[model samples]
Target: MKQLLEILGFIALVQGVAGLVHEFTDWDWGFVQRLDVLDGYEVYASVALLVLGCALLAAAESRASR
Candidate 1:
C-alpha cells in the first residue's frame, strides 16, 4: 500500500512539474496540456496535482514509519 502511494505520488509530482514547466516555458510536454476538459484551467489543475502529489508522498512516509 505504501509503495502504491509512493508510485502515485511520484507520477503526480512529475506530471505537475511538467505542466508548470510547459505553461511557463512552452516546453510542449505533460498530459495537462492535452486535456480538453481542463482547457483554460490547466494551471489550476497542475497546482492541484502538485498538492495531491505532496500529500500522497507524506501519507506514504507516515505509513512507512508505522
Candidate 2:
C-alpha cells in the first residue's frame, strides 16, 4: 500500500512538473496539456496534481514509519 502511494505520487509529481514546464516554456510535452477537458485550466490542474503528489508522498512516509 505504501509502495503504491509512493509510485502514484512520483508519477503525479513528474507529470505536474512537466505540465508547468510545458506551459512556461512551450515545450510541447506532458499529459496535462493534451487534455481537451482542461483546455484553459491546465495550470490549475497541474498545481492540483502537484499538491496531490506531495500529499500522497507524505502519506506514504507516515505509513512507512508506522
Candidate 3:
C-alpha cells in the first residue's frame, strides 16, 4: 500500500512539473488532451496537483519511518 502511494505521488509530482513547463513552453503532449476540461485553470490545477503530490510523498515517508 505504501509503495502504491509513493508511485502515485511520484506521478503527480512529475505531472505537476510538466504542467508548469507546458504553461511556459506550450509544448503539448498527448496526455494533456485529457485536461481540456481544466479550460483556463490549468496552472492552478497543476499547483494543486503539486501540493497534493508533496503531501502524499510526505505521508509515504512518514509511514516508512513508523
Model 2, 8-55: lDDT tens per residue? 999999999999999999999899999999999999999999999999
Q: Over all chains combined, what TM-score does candidate 1 have?
A: 0.97
1 versus 3: better lDDT goes to: 1
Displacement of the residue 7 alpha carbon in candidate 1, Å: 0.5
TM-score of each: 0.97, 0.97, 0.87
- Residue range 1-66, candidate 3, lDDT tens digits: 689889999888888878877888887742332576887888887887899889999999988998
lDDT for model 1, on a 0 to 1 scale? 0.96
Candidate 3 runs further than 4 Å off = 30-33
Error of 2 at 17 (Å): 0.4
- Give residue 35's lDDT in candidate 2 (0 to 100): 94
Model 2 clashing-pair count: 0
What ranges in model 1 sit over 4 Å off?
none
Off by over 4 Å in 2: none
Worst 10 residues of 3 by lDDT: 27-36
